[model samples]
Target: MELFAVEIRTPQWQPMILWYTSALNMKAAVRSVEDGYALLAGRGWRLSLLELQEDEPRDRSAISLALEVENLSAVRERIESLLMEPSAPIETSDEGFLQWTTTDPDGNRIKLFQFVAVD
Candidate 1:
């Protein structure tokens, strides 16, 4: 089965939308402020954010999303330019994957990785 989208609930919708758009360099494929929902599409993946009520607890630590990119350096530069710090230093895994982790405004862990062929 093909995965179409992943949905997240956040107390802050507008800022979350802006964060995803800027971080991923993607635009919302579907957005409805009145309905409290936004769907962001990038690199064939869909990220949907739904508005959460004030009473709802927001704990994003349990949700970690990993994205594979072609240019790890470029993505790192973009993240640095945004003035946000990564959760840890970037390192190459034993499996030859260059990876790092960062959190969004709501504290959702985002893992960025790229496959590096070792000569």
Candidate 2:
């Protein structure tokens, strides 16, 4: 089965929205400030952002999302330009992928990778 969307709850909705839009270079397909939600689309992924309630528990360090990208380096550069530091150095796996991890403003982990065929 194919994946459709991922729901991310955060207290910082505006910055989260801005971050996703800028990093992915895509606009929200759906958004409702009143409802406190937004849906953002990239090449083959959809991110749903939900406003965190005051009573809800937030453990941003525990959230992690893996994304397959076309150009890992470019994505890394874009992220750095946005002033977000990657958590680790980019590395290639024996399985033929270049990867790196980074965190959002609220400390949500984002792992990005690109497949690279090894000769």
Model 2 segments beyond 4 Å from truth? 1-60, 84-87
Q: Estimate each model's TM-score.
A: 0.47, 0.47
Give a tens-digit lDDT track for model 1, residues 2-118. Answer: 344566778888989999999888789999898898879999788878898889776656565667788877887788766555346789887688987777777776668888987
Residue 90 local lDDT, model 1 = 88
Please estimate how well model 1 matches the true structure, expressed as its whole-model Cα lDDT. 0.77
> Across residues 14-75, which tens digit of lDDT does each residue of candidate 2 receive?
89999999987967999999989998999878887888877878766655566778888888
RMSD of each: 11.4, 11.2
For every model shown, the clashing-pair count is 0, 0
> Which candidate ranks first by lDDT, i.e. highest?
2
The deviation in Å at residue 17 for candidate 2 is: 32
Runs of candidate 1 with Cα error greater than 4 angstroms are: 57-119
